[model samples]
Target: MKKIVRLISAVICFFQLNVQAEEPKEYTFAINSAVTPLLHAAFINETIKTVERSVAPAKLKVLYVELPELERLIENHQTDFFISTAATIRRYQDLGARDVLTASSPFSKNPNRSEGSLFIVKEGRSDINSISDLKDKRAAAGRPTAFGMYLAAMGEIAADGYDPKTFFKSTQFYGLNRDQIIKDVLDGKADVGILRACYLEDAVNRKVVTTDQLKFINLKNDPEHICLHSTRLYPNWSFGSNPSVPPAVLSAVAAGLIAQKPVGIGLYWSVASDFTAIDNLLKSLQLGSYQRFSKEWFWQRIIEYRFWVLGTLAAFALLLIHSFIVSRTVNIRTQELKESLKRESQSFHEAQEAHRRLMKMQRAAVVGQISSLIAHELNQPLAGIKLYARTLQRAKDSGTLTEDKLGTALAEIRTDADLAAAIVERVRSYAKGARSERVSSEVSELVNKAVREFKRQSGERVEVKLTQAQPVHVIVNPLEFELVIINLLRNAAQALQELGVSNPKVDLTIRRSDNSAMITIEDNGHIEKETIAKLSEPTNSTKADGLGLGLQIVRSIIENHGGKISFSQATSGGLRVEIRLPVQEETK
Candidate 1:
């Protein structure tokens, strides 16, 4: 009896092991050929990564299937899940396959249905002006069944008065690979080649073919061609889960695919794809048939007569109300326009008078600000002349008829006089009311020159620093840019003088980064927080001496150069002013 019991227990254990082995532990999925990029991104990378993170590294088999193979997989119940176009999913649903998730295509980001096909030829080839011209030309296509190559091309050809069966002399179809077709065209193996519309941009950007090597022809002008398109955009792809898939697994797959992101494609997720257009195309060509939805009629009746009638009536009412409102607005606008015309002439004259007075005030203020500097500049030459004259008198008094030495002394005197004349000339140049000169200048050189000139005139007490030493180049009106620097320096000098700082210093710094140039001036003047707040607020200077138009003019000049200025307190207890200027990219 004990032996018999042991035998039964062993048999029971063997049966239990068989049951566990037979349980389903693997799943299979197929990628629709149209959505290969998305397949690689989501399933191959993201889905497996997600499963690895949660469950142990169980090998998941993924199969790629074309449309026909996908249909067969469903018929034989070989696939656990599948991804396909919206129309195909609808057809499967009609044939009793339930949708678990909706699939989206790569081109679904752009809502405007713009798309088109291309007909390209080799460099300088002008024999073909239209698709009808391909009657006897050899053409190569990336994919014969591709929406762009076959459907879009056929639609264009039919419009151009040609039938696909007899239009071209010969046609060669390759699976979806553009590199092969491009190579074939470049080698003169094919008279014509076809590509998706925007596909050429990527090729040109990557230097696959020089722009001169390719010529595009026969673009359709439909609304669908006006927006994101290449060779007549067909509907996008659809993703769906298997009907036998558990809800939890279906939800997980949808979440995983939506979360997948690999570069180039921006924030992506599945959206409802409108395949009615593709369905219509297929029906027209009798390439495939779609079964009608059973509840489609119920929804169709509610929309056809009920929703559309109400919408039409509502739109008509809105149009009438809009017209009435517009008529009333037009009458009011006419009266307002007459009143505006009466005021325009008076306003123009007043504006001109104001502008004239403002210009006079500006000139007076600028002259006043530089009065001391101009006097100092003049005094240098006068002082030199005085010294030379004294020397000549001494030489004459002690001379033993030294004519050669006296002549040398006279030449020295003449040199000092010429130096005075040069100062006068510089003043004249500044005083003259002429347009500034425009020139191309290296940025580092300009900043260095400006700082040296400031230091030479203003004395050694002012410390200048050019923190950023990168060389930037620009085309600018030199006089205008120089004037801007001078004005800023003058303001900084005045700020230091007002604070009565002994080591009165102004620092000039230059910087270049990315696509811009920056010049900064820091002065050892303790500007109050309150004062700094009101600096750019158009407040006049608190000084009792002259008008505070220096900062205002500096702002205008920098703005004209496409630069901006900002003020802040320096860490070393002074005022800091930064000017940022944009660097223009040179075109080759």
Candidate 2:
């Protein structure tokens, strides 16, 4: 009986072992069709090995399909695990999927994320160095669903000031693999090609292509971790578990992926990276879940939140009313300001014309005063000439006119006649008011001439001294400047003679200061302080015989030549007149 029981227990144990072996736990993994068939197989095999090791003694069944099918599977809770690009991963995450791990590429700058797309053209293709250069050029890329290659490439192109949809002459999507796009670029079928970063390196390592055959477009230097990339880095392919997955299994799978060594060429699995940038890219492109929540979707949401919508509408209406009121007010003020400016401009022009006429009248008054002085100066010479003529006639009639006497009388008559002519000529030139051209002239020369003319005209016994420290040259209208000096000197001599000083003296000094020439004329004569103050004013004179126009005209002429004239009490006595004129740069 005991032997019979042992046989039955052995038979039951064999059956139990067979049943357990035949019915191992099963987990479904879905992979998108972004990779080639062979690559897809390899990826699946690798994932199976990882999951088998993690959940010991359990089996994993992977279903390879396109992105749309995988998305459906995730939504339907039919997929326990999913491996795909960031965009699809974000869709899965939105459906309550937990991130398991993210794949790390050998060319990634960070192990936690994948590098961006790479733009390339054949060697000697100089015309395709930049995205703008790609305009009207044939280009190739992976499928539009590829985030790391096609979408990323489009993002980079748009960032470089080009519309991806319209910039290129033609854009061809070479299925879901990068190899065909690269081949198209190399074979001259396409002018430019874009692929995920490190694809070229992989091809080169595999001996399928040479680096010398192609040029990288928009290649950026990244010292932190070397790679060829153009767009911003994003989280790499993600492996996530569906919400129905058990917590224990998910924990075990995460631990297993973290423990696995790099498969090849520094490719490994790591803790899932942040998907924020990937979500932003999808939103920007209006893809995946973001596609449904577009501008129209936003309006729907606003309708759902009716209170917020009403508040926004009310605020917008108020803003429009305020803007209208402010614009009207601004327009009214602008018109008023324009009218005011027009009136001000008209007043300014009228004032300018009036000032010009007043200057002309003042000049005429000055000419009148100078004419009087010239007539007075010519009177003596005329009288002398007449007396000499009478003497010569008398000598001839008395028969006492010797040849020597006749010669002496004739010479005296000629001398007086020449003096009268010179006075008349001087007056004529002054009255003409010729606009003399400005030229560089020595200030000392002008002062000496004025002093000599003053003595000759007034016949006053005033001691005049000129002190010049150095030669000073000024830019001036010589004729007008000389008149200015003459007027000042004549006034000084006249004042000295009127004061009746025992030893009347005048001193003229010239010196250079910086870029200016200074002339000072001082006299030793009694003059009141009030007289000095009013010296430059028109028709204001201290002397009973003075017209006071001399000093005023002198001031005007000096000012017109960009010079200044001032009067001060002399250190010794009388008045001191100081004139400052701009010196010529060449002379300095």
Clashes of each: 12, 0
lDDT for residue 242 in candidate 2, whole number 0-100: 85
Off by more than 4 A, model 2: 1-25, 33-46, 53-58, 66-69, 295-588
Residue-wise C-alpha lDDT for candidate 1, range 1-588, written one tens digit per residue: 546544543454344334435553466667667555423354444544543322212234678766568777775667766666544554555445544444333444442242346777787777877666678788888555555545566656655556665666777777666766777888888887777555665677677887678766665455433222324455444455556554445454555445544334442335544555555555544343332323544566667799787898999999999999998999887997878877998899999999999987876665554443445444544665677678778877777437787687677667657645654554465456444455667776777666765554455466666666766776666545654676577667777876788887777777776777787888877877777776776436645553355566567557757788888899877888888888756779
**Structural RMSD, model 2:** 17.5
TM-scores for every candidate against the unseen true structure: 0.38, 0.43
lDDT string, candidate 2, 1-588, tens digits: 546544544454344335436665777878876643212345446766877655545566778787668777887889888887756667556568766788765455464456478888899986666767878898898776676668888877766767776878888887656688888988999998887766777678777778899888877776544557877777777778888766666766765565555664455667655677777667667665675567866877878999988999999999999999999999987997889999999999999999999978866876787675555556656766777788888988998888998888788678768756765665566567655468888888878876765665557788899999999888887656766876777778777777778898888899998988999999988777887778857667666766456676677678878999999999886899999999888824
Compared to the true structure, candidate 1 yields what TM-score? 0.38
Q: What local lDDT score does residue 303 receive in model 1, on the 0 to 100 scale?
A: 79
